[model samples]
Target chain A: MTAEALTTILIAMLGGAIRVSTPFIFVALGETLTEKSGRINLGLEGNLVLGAMVAYAISFHTGSPWLGVLAAGFSGVFLGLMHGSICSLKKVNDIAVGIAMMSFGIGVAFFFGKPYIQPSAPRLESLPLGGWASNPALQQALEINPLFIVGILIAIVMWWALANTRVGLVVRMTGDSEPAARAMGINPIKVRILATAAGGFLAGIGGAFLSLSYPGSWNEGLSSGQGLMAVALVIFARWNPLRCILAALLFGAAGALGPALQSVGISQGYYFFNAAPYILTLFIMVAATGSNSARAAPGELSIAK
Target chain B: MAQAETSFATPPAYDTARIRASIEAVAIPLGALVASAIIFSVFLTLLGKSPLQFFELVWRGGFGSSFSLQNTLQRATPLILTGLAFAIPARIGLVMIGAEGALVIGGFAAAALAIPLVSAEAPVYLTMLLMVLIAMAAGGAWNAIAGWLKHSRGVNETISTLLLTYIAIAIMNFFVEGALRDPASQNKPSTMPIGKDYMVGNIPGTDVHWGLVFGLVLAVALQVLMSRTTFGFAARVTGGNPRAALAQGLPVGTLIVVCSAIAGACAGLAGYFEVAAIHGQANASLVAGYGFTGILVAFLARHNPLMIVPVAIMFGAIEASGGLIQRRMDMPDATALVLQGIIFVVLLASDSLYGRFAIFQPKISTERT
Candidate 1:
């Protein structure tokens, strides 16, 4: 490929990375919180899809993208609550319940989402942060969504709280050792459940972005396992909220390889590029697994350590 | 307060009264099923639909007649394989959710491999063996990734497996839509048909293909592998306590990967049959939710391979009935999913029953009184 084309590909890739990373950022933050509290919600894929549908439907009805995002987050909370409550029941496996909830969530979303497929919904606005650039290509690549900033801020706050706050200590204690947590009179179950619900809420918001922002539309195909991939991303980030943000951006760049290449008239190996995120996840997991840092994962969390 | 005392008094006698405990397990799940139906009815009521009419429609559509039973069996055939896919690995304590991925990749690989054999005058049995092997290999490798990750990295198998599913599906879509698209079908991209003569034949009396038999055979084989073999014992030991298994010198990682590969192979075989027997080509037809439904089936069967057969057929009935409900009640076809989800959650919660049944606990305190 020509140097100009290579440059174009690089710019498009950066742009695509920003767009795709928004949802990952939201979901990774949520999963980090949930994992920190010693519970895992694998059903966020369901939450993402349902949130996408709700965001689209609500935006269509209210003509407000913000409202749609809020409604989507609430819908995610509902799913999270269901998963948390069911898992909290004695003898119920959290992972299994999460899997079941995923199917239930997606099924419900598809069923209810059928009507909104054709209708136009209000979409989120992007800020043209690259207006200062003289090059048109640079300007085109600068359309950043506001939610990206919000996700970053949430990650920073979560990181501070997890390291410093009393609630964070309790959550960490619960994840580190249930016996210690119980001895300290903390209800591990409740903490885990709340964390899961909060995580779901964020995932739901992430889903809403898909429908109400870039590639903006309501459809059954809007999500392709971003929620599920977030779980892997959590382990890659070592369950730290701040690290999750960086991981999300890296995943986004990997995911954008296909479309970004396509923009530069390179269509060969698009499938391989599309498979990049998963491949990256597998390799990162391999690198991190059984290692000192990964071993540092809280003992109670199932993904690592 | 009395951990040692409580632990020392657990032995109990078995009697006819224990049947009540079994009944309660079934009863609670049944109640949950009914409750989901009621809840679904309420949703329908809000949608301005009659709940009574929907049930009648489902009854008539799913099992009220022989034709429906046949349809149910046909649908259940795939579920049986996919359910076994989930159930088999579950026996060894791995939650392998990549069956869906295995199914798609298996179907694609099966169809792709069939391309070369079609023009040659090969023996029919040889051709079938080649197809099954190709399909199983595709699926086995797809699932082995998750297993390898879990055993190697301590990465949770569930999410990695699930992510692999999306990658698998995307690969299938790209291949079918781009490289393998049949020239004649413009709108919907698909592979070339495998032709009628090469297609799998149905059972003599039923419309269901020989895949149903394969599913049953697999279930039985897995039952044996899980119950009567040294491998089964090792796997169980690993599953029950990985640390203990390691202490005992069991090859825990190999067991996990091998079990996952077997599970994926089952799902891949299901995909192969779906292509060769039903769709006759790989397309959007292969993307249906059979793999996800199998997870429910596996869970409902309590992860028992032997139990998967009947439970699969039951779910098959529900799926067959979904169309009837949709046609008669104007409801969406996802009603079966709602019911399945409810049953799954309730059944899982019922796992607490092992110690709770009064019959299972000794009555020494009562005897003293």
Candidate 2:
């Protein structure tokens, strides 16, 4: 291949990475928060789809993307509440309940979202980071969504708070040991529920981003299990909120490989490339799980050692 | 010899208290179903449809007529098998979400095997045997990946199995839509059909295939395997307390993998039936939510293989009636999914009732009595 073509492909790949990574960033952050609290919510995928549906419908009705985001977050909180409450009940397994909630949330989303599939919604716009560039490709590649930056900022804040703040310490203690948390006079259940709700909010926003931004459309097939993949991403990130952002971007890049390759007349093994993100996650999970220095996972987290 | 013979004899009578406890256990799921129906009724009202009419339609379309009953049974067959897939592994304390992957790969394997045998002079029974074996092997291997990860590397089975599912679906898509695509099926895009001669036969006096019988048989067999075997005892022990089982010198890792493989094999068999009896070939048509629905059935049945049979059929009837409800009531097809989801959550939450209910808790105030 010519250098010019190769460079174009590389640039397009970067652009695709950023575009796809936005949702991953939000979702991984959400999952990281939930995991840090020693409870894993696998139903984030449902939150994502429902959030997208709610966001799109609200945006279409109100002509405001921000409100749509809020609505999406609310829907996520609603799901998180259900998940947290059911899991808090004696004998109810959190992971299983998360799976159930996933199905339930998706059902509700599809049921309510039937009408919003065709309508256009006011979408969140990308910041013109490359406005001064003369090349169209360069400008397009540089146009980063604002949510990407917000996600990074949230990750940074979360990292700092987790290390220093009392609330963060409570969460850490609760996750490390329920007895320790109880000794400290903190309710582990409450902490987990709060963390789960916060995580759901972020995931819901991520879903909104998918519908109201890059993909810029609403459909049932819009989400291809990105929410579910985020759970693995959180673990791969070692439950670090900061690492979650980078991991999400990496996953986004992996997911975009097939489409980017397709755009440049390279269609061989597109399906395999499409499967890259899931394969990468499995590889990371195996590696992280076997590694001695994979970081000390939360004690109460079922996925954690 | 007299004492031994006396000990082997049947107990005097069925215990009324034990029977009542069993009935109470069932009440949780029943209550959840009723609650979900109420919640769904409100939803239907919001959508401008009558919940009564919806329920009536479900009854009418699912089991009112002989034709509908057959359709429900046909739908329930794979569900029963898949439910066993989930329920069996769940009994061993492994949440194997890779059944969808197993189903897809199994179906693909069935189709792949059939392609060669269709034109060959292979005997019909041999072809069927080859299909079942290949399908189960593919599925078993698929699930074994997650089991190995869990037992050897401490990776969580849930995430690993789920990720593998995506990879499995992608692999099948590549084969069916590209390499194995029949030139004639252009618009829908499917693998080559497995031909009428190689197809499974219908049960006597019914349009439904023999898979329903296969499902029922497997359920009963698994029930016996789980309740009456030493291996099942070890599996139960492992599930209840893995560390304790390890302390007892049980090969916990091997049991985990083997049990998971068996679970995957069950789902794979379901996939084989789908391809051989229903879809006629492996394609996107096999990607229906049978695997997911099976999870609910497993939960509703509390992961008992025998209970999975009835639970799966109930769900199957609900699913079969979904389209009819949509036509007659102007409700979305998602209505059925909503009900199923609600029932699943409620049933899971009902787990709390196990030790908390006084009916299940034996009375200790014998002195006062």
Candidate 3:
């Protein structure tokens, strides 16, 4: 390939990385928080689709995209409540609940969001970050969505709070040892419920990005399992909020490879390229799931075993 | 020993412990189903629709007539197979949800294989047999990858299976749109048809295809395999207590892999039937949600192979009625999904109530009392 061709692919990938990674960022971070609290929510995929639908429908009806984002988050919270409550019961497996919640969330979304499919919703606009570049293609590629920045900021804040705040300490303690958390007069169930809800709020925003920003529409096929992929991304990130951003970007780049190659007329193996992230995730999982990664995981995580 | 067992078992008048256990097993899931129906009724009522009509239509569309009953059974064929796909791995204590991917890959493999055999003018029976074998082999291999990873590398089976599912679908799409696309299949890219001679037909005097028969035989075989054989015992031991199984020198890894492969093969057969009996070709049309719904079926059956049949048929009935519900209730097709979701959640939640019910508990044996 020529240098120009290489540059084109890189730029396309970079653009794709940013566009695709925003959802990954929110979802990975949400999963990180939930996992740190010693629970894994695979149903975040459900939250994502529902969130996208709610975001689009709310934006269409209320005329404010941010309110749609808020509505999406609350919608996520509702599912999280269902998951947390069902899982908290004795003998109720959280993993199975995650699966059930995923189906329920998607079902609810599809049921309610059917009518909003055709109508256009007000969308969140990207910040003009690429104006400094002279070429229009480069300029268009550089237009960063505002949620990208907010996601980064949230990651940093989460990192700080996880270390410095009492709530964070409680979460960590509860995750590491339920008995110790109980002895300290903390209700681990309540902590888990709240963490799941808050984590869901983030995942909802991630869903908002899919429908309100890039690919900007409400549809059933809006998500091709991005929510489920985020759960994998969290494991790859080793449950750290800051690392989640980097992991998500890598995934985004992988996701972007197909469209990037397609844009540059290198469509020979587009489908194969689309499979890259999943293959990469499996390999990363194989490599990461040794003694060190296990130590990095919260001691009480049900998914760990 | 068989004769002795039959003779003694026939006259057991007070097997309360055995009787209660069986009753509890059946009663819990039934109660969950009823509860979900009630909740779904409330949902319908809130939307100003009559829940009674919705169910009435379900009965009418799914099982009211012989034709509808056949349709329900026809749909249940795949569900039965996919439910076993979920159930087998679940018996080995792995929650493998990659059956959908296996189905796609299996069907794709069968179609891809058919192209070569058809071009060579292979005999019809031979072509069908090879296609079935190839489909089962492909699916079993696909699911085995996840099982292998889980046992050998300590990667979580659930996540691994889920990832593999995406990869499987991608691979199929890659082939169908490229190497395997039949030029004749315009508007929808698909593999070359297996031709009418190779098409799977329904059972004699019934509209239900031979796939339902396949499902029944497999369910019975698996039920016996799980409850009667040494291999099944090892797998159950591994599921019940991995540490103990390892201590007893049972090959836990092999059991996991074997169970997963068997599960995959079941899903693969479903895919083959889907291609040969229903679609007559492979394409994006093969990407139905049967694999995911099978998870609910297996769970509702408590992962019992025998129980999967009734549960799968029930789900199939609900599924077959989707169009009817949509027309009668003026609801989206997702109404079925809503009911399913509610049923699944309630079923899992009802897990906690199993031991709590005093009546279902085994009667304490007391000579003095």
- What is residue A172's positional error in candidate 1, in angstroms? 2.1
lDDT of 2 at B105: 88
Q: Per-residue lDDT tens digits of candidate 1, residues B1-369? A: 245545555442233235455565556555566766777788779889888887776666667888887788888888988998888788888888888889999989999888778877577778888999989999988898788878876776887787788788878878876787788878878888888887899999877789999998999999999989999989988888889999999999999999989989999999999999998888878978789889988877777787788888888887888877777766666667666766666666666555565543444334322
Q: Write the per-residue lDDT of candidate 2 for residues A126-159, one digit (tens) a residue.
A: 9989899887988998899888888889999999
RMSD of 2: 3.4
Q: Write the per-residue lDDT of candidate 2 for residues B170-235, one digit (tens) a residue.
A: 998888767788889878777889898889999999989999998999899999999899888999
Supply the global lDDT for candidate 1. Answer: 0.83
Model 1 misses residue B306 by how many Å?
2.4
Q: Candidate 1 on A66-95: residue-level lDDT in tens?
A: 999999999999998888888888777788
Model 2 docking category: high
Q: On lDDT, who's better, 1 or 2?
A: 2
Instruction: Please give the C-alpha DockQ score of model 2.
Output: 0.84
Q: Fraction of the real A/B interface contacts present in each candidate?
A: 0.58, 0.83, 0.85
Candidate 3 chain A weakest ten by summed lDDT: A287-296
Ranking the candidates on lDDT from highest down gives 3, 2, 1
Q: Candidate 2, A233: how far from true, in Å?
A: 0.5
lDDT of 3 by residue, A34-149 (tens): 88888889899999999999999999999999999999989988988888888889998888899999999999999998999999999998998998898777888889999999
